[model samples]
Target: MRRLQSPRRTYDWGSREEIPDFLGQPVDGERVAEVWLGTHALAPSLVDGPDGPRSLLEVSGELPFMLKILAADRPLSLQVHPDAELARAGFDAEEASGTPLDAPHRVFKDPHPKPEMVLALTTFDTLVGFRPTAEILRVLGALPTSLTQKLAERLRAEPGFAGIVALVEQLVTDPPTPQEVGDVVAACADGVQRRTDVKRAYLTALEVNEHHAGDVGVVISLLLNRLTLQPGEAAYLATGIIHAHLKGMCLEVMVSSDNVLRAGLTSKHLDPQGLVRCVSGGMSRLARVEPEQFGESTDVFSPGLREFALSMTQVSPAEPAGTPLPDQGRRIIVCTGGEVELVNEHDERLPLRRGSAVYADAADGTIRAHGTGEVGQAYTPTAEDRATPLTDLV
Candidate 1:
């Protein structure tokens, strides 16, 4: 097992305190959004063990999974990730157009599909896939504004998934006027005061509008499912499922890809048509994940993906023998709290504390966790693709 130094990515919609406080680092007063703990080329981790602070790619090769500790301060962009077919086509088209990989307008960063899952470490709130057309109409109808009624009429013109697609396309492409958006918000405020059955939806719209006032996405918020996950709960986001994280912190695991097609709530380049193509799958509900509990202390979050599964082992004084972790090829272990140490078959130790992480190879065999803390392991069962054994050690 080797210690790894991860990179912190900042964004405008990120928390100014949550990430830094959790990592036990001094706050720089910036919005820290995510901590990347894998080799994903765009923001690869570093080998900060005894040897040096070299890039993880040079030492361990390209790992197929990326792990992130995401903390959202406000609603993120309403975005969708492409599935395999769309990803490949988009990537090839961009490459043919001579778009640089780091170009601001570039859509697909890699040819890989991005299927991600988020495990709530706090009371995480998000706007998930589209609600049923009936439900959406009900929410919009509760607002009872001219713009919302027009939107409802548009949705009702076709109704169902087809109508939703067309309406979303219109909203992203030729959005409502700012005054119309404000009317929707005002109507939502009125609905909130009237205590409608869809009060949650109305409140969510106002919440979104608080940050992005007059933005079309605030009005579009009425079309999506409002989901709030308590601590320890999780949501697995399949490709083509549109979602926007609203608040709080979570551990996100995904296939190693950087392609994101966005429609709203961000200053980055928007891809309305591309986002429509990605969401053409017509997903309309959240995929809530049920962790597979191993023994009494370990929770394995595997969403049937060939790429990665997250294993969380709780270490405590009551079980001094330490919880035995499975040997899952190349894995990255992150400590969420307290202090912990991983003991390999050779009795070699890798100490970890809150916000610390380490890279362990399959050659270490089944390691045991000692001390008291929560250890998060990003791994998947893949016998064919395990990295070569690392010989250098502490």
Candidate 2:
């Protein structure tokens, strides 16, 4: 096991102080959004052990997945991710077709699907999946003018996810004129002025659109489920589930890929067609995750994913030397909230604390944990792919 250092990603929507303060570190007031702990090329973690900061890629020879503490001060872009096949195809096509990898408009970054899970470190708000037709219709009924009438008519005539898909297809492929857009905005603004409940949805819809002026994803928000996750709660995002993290901090674990196919709401690449192609075409409902309590010190946060599993544990000062590491696949552990003393097989204790992580290879076997405060682990399982190892982590 080796202690590692994570890389922080500074984005515009990030908080200027949240992450800095969370890690008990000082910053120059730069907006820091995410601190990535895995190897995903864009920001690969380096070994920060007794030696120095050595890139994980150079040391381990493979990037499992990048872990992050995502701090969102504003809404993230309305984005979709490609499944494995599509991701591979798109990345290869871009490469073979002579598109620069770092180009501003590049969409697919790698040939792997991005399935992610977010565990709230604070109260996290997000918009995920599509709202049912009836719910959307009710929201639209409160809007002003013939716009509401037209939408209501559509919901009445053609409801369900299919109908929403049709509407989205139309808006994306054959968008309305600029005049039409301006008119809709005006009507929404008017509705808000009239103290209509629809105004809240409309304003949210409009805010998301600011990132993607012409994308249909702007209006799509009006038809999606809005959710707020308290600290320790989690939400899993599969490929093509349109989602935008609105605010708050969270621990995010995802597959080892960066193949985002965006429809709008970002300065990054916009691949509307690719997004539509990869869309799961199902309504998204609140699937809030509750951690499975493990004794007194451990709570496991496991999203049903094949590639990765995360466990959150709070070690009290009185707890004894904990269980040994699993005799399974590769395991990566990170301590974000407090200090931990890890003992190897031969009883060599290594001290670790916040912002510190370690990679335990399959060959090394299980290590014992004896310390105080919170720690999380992300690892690949050796057993069947269908079963999540969060239940099995001792």
Candidate 3:
């Protein structure tokens, strides 16, 4: 069993305490954004060897999926990821154009569709997809701002998904002025004090304003569905789902690609055309995934995605059967909470604690668990996921 060493990433919007305390580390006020646990070329996790610490890419090659612990204190960008077809075309075009992979303007990191799922470890707030047309009009009608009235008029004239897409196009092409943005925020704040049925919508706008005061995304919030995932609840986004995560911590799992098309509320490179391209998929509903109980102690969270699924198990002194994890593909187990001993198919046992993890090759077969506390197992498509182009599979 190879004990994997994961990398912790820091970003400005990250929480100061969530990740540190989760790993039992003393809080130092460092903003820990994400803990990457995968074999992706960029920020690959490592494992120790007699020679030295080796990249997981060298040890296990590239896994189909990546797992991460995300802790956010502020709103992230309103963004979308390209589908498998778009990812390949976009990446190839960028590559042919002689754009460096590490360049700030580079978009696609890998030729894989980035369909992601976030399982909340804390109360998580997010703006996902588009709200219903009727709902959007009702919320906008309450606001007396010119921006809101114009948006409401357009939505009423067209209605439904077409109106939503048109509104997105208008916002991206002709972004709201700072004064117009401020007016919408002020209207939403005032509405929050008076409106009851539409209070949640007003609050969502205000919440985005609290983080990004003058960004055009504050008005864009009116277009999305505000969703809150309680602890242990999960949300999944297939390719082309537009979203922005606001506040709280989560366990994020996705294809081993870092491709993102951001439009606003971020300091990262902006790509309005890329965002609109991704959003043109025409999705109407928010995607929510429920965990399926597997065996006695394990819960499998797979939205039937071909790339990867996550299995979480808890074992204590009370029940001695431990966790029997399924093999979806290449297996990597991380002890997110408490202490546990992992027994691989070869009968090798590795003891893992709060922040420790292990990786197993396809030849290793199934890995079982023992001891106490919680463990998360990642299941990808054996060894084929990374080696093959996702375009062929999807």
In candidate 1, residue 75 scores what lDDT? Answer: 90
Write one digit per residue (lDDT tens) for candidate 2, span 1-394: 7777777888888999998887768978899998887778777888765566788877677756667889998788777787888888888998998887678788877788998888888898888787777778877776654654676788788898778776666666666655566566666667667777552677776666565464556666677777778887777787878777888999898898777776655666676777778878467633555565546666666566657767777766575667444334566787767777877776667777776778766555666777776777777633443343332100
Top of the candidates by lDDT: 1
lDDT by residue (tens digit), candidate 3, 151-236? 89988999877778889879977899989999988888788777653738788888888888889888888888888999877877
What TM-score should be assigned to candidate 2? 0.87
- Residues 1-394, model 1: lDDT tens digits: 7788888999999999999998998988999999999898789999875656988888778888899999999999989999999999989999999999989899999999999988888999998888888888898877668877887998888898888888888899998888999988888888888788483888998999998988889988888888888987777788988888999999999999989999889988999999988885553646776666666798777777888878778898887688887654688888988999889989998888988988888688888889988888888744422321212110
Number of the predicted model whose TM-score against the real structure is largest? 1
Each prediction's whole-model lDDT (CA):
0.84, 0.72, 0.81
The parts of candidate 1 lying over 4 Å away from their true place are 197-199, 382-394
Clashing pairs in 2: 130-284, 325-366, 325-367
Off by over 4 Å in 2: 49-51, 174-203, 206-217, 323-328, 382-394
Candidate 1 local Cα displacement, residue 169, angstroms: 0.5
Residue 66, candidate 2: how far off, in angstroms?
2.3
lDDT of 3 at 79: 94
TM-scores for all candidates: the values are 0.94, 0.87, 0.93
**Candidate 3: which stretches are off by over 4 Å?**
197-199, 281-283, 381-394
